[model samples]
Target: MGPWQLSVSALAQPDKISHLPLRWIRGSRAVMAFTVSVFLSSILSVITAANPPYPPSTVIRKIVWAPVDTITRKAAGSDNLPVTWADDEAIYTTWGDGWGFEPRVPNKLSMGFARIVGAPGNFTGTNIRSPAEQLGGGRSGRKGWGIISVDGVLYLLMGHADRQGGQAQLAWSHDHARTWTFANWKFLQFGLMGFVNYGKDYKGARDNYIYSYSHDGPLADTPADRFILMRVPKNRITERGSWEFFERIDETGHAVWTSDSKRRGAVFYHTDGCLRSAMTYNAPLHRYLWWQQIPVPKGSADRGDTRFEGGFAVYDAPEPWGPWSTAFYTERWDVGPGEHGDFPAKWMSEDGREIYLVFSGNDSFSVRKATLVLAQKY
Candidate 1:
């Protein structure tokens, strides 16, 4: 009887309130006041189910206007070009052949080459490519390409022809923009290889991965180079599936994967006699690769100019591999003085909020979407 006086004699029991009678002690004081009001409503529902309400924003609802046709002007007339966002919303551009095959298509058979499918919202300048029998034709051309949509399906990462004949080819797309199903014509044996880019992480329930690279050797006549990390399984986009290579570092002809608000992971490339331009992050100690000597300011890789110039510069990463930090510079509104240029940019929607900048301008090659808003703390 000393444990705090036996809890004050168990609340001063009068035979523990006797077998309560007297209208059962007024219905036991209304059943002990409804069990202390359901124990304070379950402690306020476990403190509002452990907090999370909303405070971090970037909104630009819709501005999709893609239609610069003539088979995207013979696939942007070839040279490190890229445009991706295909699930049926359409927009998948690619270009190469700066050297390999010489007939860069585009002589109007509806435009020698093709791969266009507009009609998502506002690309109504009209050119809508999509016809050459759903765009097919393979030689040892078509460089650095990577397009992903996984669950809704649409996967293409090219560099085809090899089977003792040469290397590169891993394509997939299931009847939406028409047809394409080549599971492997030579899925990465590295040779003049150039899928030079691709990155996706999705977060949370986890299951979204596609990191493709290679643009400087194995087939510019075998120099033996390396860079691979492909694990795209958000539901399946086949290549016999199952991949994991990670870490080979720069052969750089092109590679962009951004995100850096401290979630970590950054990579920007082009260092193989493209002269130079680099950035890397995935650090705890190592993985910090660097070589950005800065010197892209002469007509900013010109092509005509309608505003927004050149390309390469992406930032936003929590983990695709990084220790990055550079908020915005994907051609930062084509940077100062007379502004009207912005080139080959990508990172078109990933919580960092849409940024699909492309520019060769007026003569045609304009694809823009820069909607990123993040500034709030109170």
Candidate 2:
């Protein structure tokens, strides 16, 4: 809770260690002194292998900043606009730094790529590549973003992050992650709105198409849970008017789909909305893994003035949009006294069992390694 008060060493739960062999336990404690992140990750790796009665959980390890953060020295300038997606050889992400959602900031948002120096499959050694630079896609602003790679092509699903009154744009990159085609005439529509704010949750090449989701609300509003689902044919996303919206089955037990975007209802609904979320297709568990920030309630309505505050929660579903169940949650863990905690699905293990939960707020990029266990059926 409260800025940086969360100690990494304390993240280990003794109960979870009870089943470990004594020698292994002793070795893990030895790692407590310095390599907290590594030790926690190793332990959880074993825990997941054990098939614990819960979705894997987390062991927060450390706090870090994108090397670029050292230069900007300001939260609003760099690494703040977060949307992550990945390819097999590398984990890729694009962010909005010094871009604006307000009139003064410009309608088109500038974007930058998050750089990681290491080679493929070695995710542990990653740190933000210093000195952020603009990418081809960053030339304009977007909201509800998601990215996927197919046959060496990176496709970014971008929508309006502001009230610009635009639809989702598809950006493409060939020649190995160099640059991209920012926007096309085609866009996604749901309930009379085109900029559904997607990139927060997406699954590429599933069910013969690229499945994605969007939420209806402003950025600052958390617990804002109405989500609409959409899909586009693989490799055909650039074609205007080719996208399809999710239509729930009617009470009469018949599947229905209407060309009218206004008639589309939210595929998944929640009482309160989660501000930011990440969606991943976990190969190990064969399920859709989603992580989101549950905002802290405001004022006496909650317990005093607790504003801009939130924590993390992970959910699992049979598909990208439906029948979701909680896999992990830290209701009391505060990534934000004034900020939010999030998951970059691309940074997760292939099995979908573990990931690094990144926290942003008060000018810091803190991270904790987390995972899912099968705990209690949810």
Candidate 3:
């Protein structure tokens, strides 16, 4: 038998060792002690493997929020803000379940597009009354959770088209947010999807493929066990067959992809599960930033009123499929960061240190400035 097995077997039969030579007995005791140490270490190794520490992010050290100048210009109950920088040096976004912008729309809409022009500190939003926009209320009303601009074409990833949040489809607009054409095919598997945005018209993209992330669930409001990633050629976003899912991270730390959606693997995990998120590429820093809602406590009264008071978390990574590190986290905040949050690429400073976060805080369109604290390099 192997030494470890022999030592274990010897310990189980104490009577057999009682008659051994004095010197030999002493030697056996030494071996037994060594064996026990090894045994305990093996068990501890397994335990540590199952529960690893939070991975340290090599890029961002932390994020500092500037609350003094934070801006929240309410548009009378508007929410669900998903924005993308366009080639025309403006941000086109969509709002849900309210009158949009100033001089409010003639009617409340479940989904309406608006164009935001000017700097983050001073900007004006004008509502677009497109014939394609949906008007109504409640969960049955369609809304957009993600939007991106590629090559001057605005693509919006919308959910609840089939009278439920589980069904999602894509719609494209050539004239900014004025009009749109919805794709016939729908995605019933992933409802909450967010595109990895870059500079205006996707100018700072790392590759030709466009990447997107979603909770591994069918419902938009519900959290999933983990996050799933998908990608398609930048030119072929409308082609269902051209899309690929992240299957696994290879040994070299690079992501492996598969055409079969069923074989997809998780790219990241969170204690509270994955929910609606906003991801953007920090061009100057060469990192990807992901912002997610920190869900309200399950049994708390605030759970029902997260619009005014809630929490959020921000993570940064070298790539989209990340070894993510926390840039900021809060279990709860006085003024909730809102259910939907995004950092538009246009407002980022040249060094990528100063930026603005746009969210639906206080149940309206909100903007807050934040400075990135980069990790010091020796």
> Considering every candidate listed, which one attains the maximal TM-score?
3
Q: lDDT score, residue 103, model 3?
A: 82
My TM-score estimates for the predictions, one after another, are 0.24, 0.58, 0.83
lDDT of 3 at 180: 92
lDDT ranking, best first: 3, 2, 1
Better of 1 and 2 by TM-score: 2
lDDT of 2 at 118: 36
lDDT, residue 236, candidate 2: 76
Give the range where candidate 1 is weakest over 10 consecutive residues by summed lDDT: 51-60
* Model 2 poorest ten-residue lDDT run: 191-200
Residue-level lDDT tens digits of model 2 in 1-378: 321233444334433332232222243342231223223434543444222212233221222323322221122333333434444445455444333211123322345444332322233322232222333332134432455655556666554433342345567777334656765364434211211211223343354566666665433232344666666676676765666666754443233455456765554444353345556555555566565555454443432112234455566554564444445555544434223334555555665556555444432333556545453433
Predictions in order: lDDT: 0.33, 0.44, 0.76
lDDT tens per residue, model 1, 1-378: 321122334333323322221121243353332232223223322333221111111121222333334212222333333444444454454433321112433432211222444432234322322332222223333433344444455555554344232465666556532455666446544543222223221112223555444433334222221222334344543644354444322223122323321221112222221211222221211122221112244444322121223333233333333222223333323331111112211233334344444433323344555454443420
Whichever of 2 and 3 has more TM-score, that candidate is 3
lDDT of candidate 3 at residue 83, scale 0 to 100: 93
RMSD of 1: 23.1
